[model samples]
Target: MKRNIVIASVAAAALLTGGTAVAVAGTQSSSTGAPTTHAADAAGTTAGESFSDAAHASGTTARASFSDAAHAALKAVPGTLDSLDLDHGARTTWDAEILGKDGKWHEVTLDASNAKVLNQHIDRDTDAEDAAEAKALRNADVSATEAARKAASSGTVTSVEFDGDRTPVWEVETVKNHKERDLNVNAQSGKVTQAPSDDDGDDD
Candidate 1:
């Protein structure tokens, strides 16, 4: 009878030990899986933050638009805009020429990124041709802005300059589908025409 009891006790202890081992193994697996899930979530969050930071940097480095630079030039000069050009060299800049009410031409330079005026000067070396061009411009019915809007029907206008060659016109340069186009808009009748190409086969 004693031997039977001993054998039964030994069997119960073995069963209990096996059950404890299984419970311990289950706890270890659950703990390990939890850390892996947390690591994956953290990695995802870091990647999202990196993308957002890159986007912000790109936005900060982009140049200002054409309209913004024109507005800034007008605000600084407070005159009739004659020509505006985007110049790229060591630094990108917007060069603006304005005819003031005092019959003098003002040249203004602005930073392309923030539209801040960098330099300005009055042109005192005016001649008969300058006076004639200014007079024709003032007498014209259409303005530079109107000419640009009319030219924009063809493509995106990049620059506008007063061309006083045979007839008073606003020369507008545009780009569309990666092709550059030069258009001349009449300052009086608001007529648009193709500009003559400057390349006279000098390379040939």
Candidate 2:
């Protein structure tokens, strides 16, 4: 009977010690949890931080951003800026439409954060759409350049295009800290205003 008691006590002690070891390990594991990914790496940007703020924070400006994009697009194909826009997604894309050397419109997208040229595509074969866009552009007294400048005041302009409406407005897309937004400027007046809505998500 005494041997049985001793054996049971030893077993109970072992169990208690094992449990204590596990508890210590768990505490250590939690205390040294893996380092968190940065907002830039995770592509998680805060909302409401203006584009100008983010750009300034990142050591850039709205004018510089436009200049960088224009330089990159023009370097690839010397052309005039046709239109502009900002693509919202995992990253804010600075997209510019340029009437390229080939005399075809080229869509160029840049990384708003770094102003790295992302992609360039020869936008071709949509004659009807092109005509409408051109007509809208002509009717607008406000240049895409002016719209971009105004947009950079609130945030980084990612894009500028004529809204698909009868009385087309300049659709300006901007981003700050990765949060995307669209603003509208009266084509004739250049009065900037919040857009009524965003367009369908970009295919890219």
Candidate 3:
């Protein structure tokens, strides 16, 4: 009877020890899984931070570059003296002092969003009556020499002058019938401004 009791006690002790070992193994496995989950979460957070930082930096750089370019371009434009604000957009009409290739001061209208050349008024063309009037005026000058007549038949002359300001009917030089000639024309009322003169300098 004493031996049997000792055997039974030993078996119970072995079973308890085996259960404790299994529990410990299970706890270790659970702890390992938690660390892996935490590691994955940290990696995801780091990746997101990196992407956000890159996007923010890119946006900042783009804005700075665009601002710099815009400032430089605006400075380069000449005669941008004043600006006007409109309902839809601002109308930036540059100073009308900038002379174009046609020997006339031209005003440029630019879009507020983008600087675009909307319209341009360079030089005015001479009309038939203005041409005749100019010829008569030049005829009055005795000392003046006359060149072949080149009519401004294509268009009418808004103004004619030696300098920037438009004066009375003045001289005109044009190509008519494939021939270049220096003629005189009138500005307003199409009166005789000047006659054809060869001795004076070129009309245009």
Scored by lDDT, the top model is 1
lDDT over C-alpha atoms for residue 154 of model 2: 55
At residue 1, give the lDDT of candidate 2.
4
**Which candidate model has the greater lDDT, 1 or 2?**
1
TM-score of 1: 0.64
Candidate 2 lDDT, 1-204, residue by residue in tens: 000000011001001000001100000011222111111111112234434454443333323244445445555555445554434445555566655434466777777555577788876655666656554544455555555555655544445565535666666655554455668877677798987752556656
lDDT of 1 by residue, 1-204 (tens): 000000111101101100001100000012222100000000001111222232232222314334455566766765566776655546656677766655677888878566689999897877777877666656555655566667755544446677665687877765443345788899789899998877854666
True-structure RMSD, every candidate: 34.6, 25.9, 44.5
Residue 41's lDDT in candidate 2: 10
TM-scores for every predicted model: 0.64, 0.51, 0.21
lDDT of each residue in 89-118, candidate 3, tens digit only: 233221111222222223333332233344
Ranking by TM-score: 1, 2, 3
The count of residue-pair clashes in candidate 2 stands at 8
For each candidate, how many residue pairs have backbone atoms clashing (under 3 Å)? 0, 8, 13
Report the number of the highest-TM-score candidate.
1
- lDDT for every model? 0.51, 0.46, 0.22
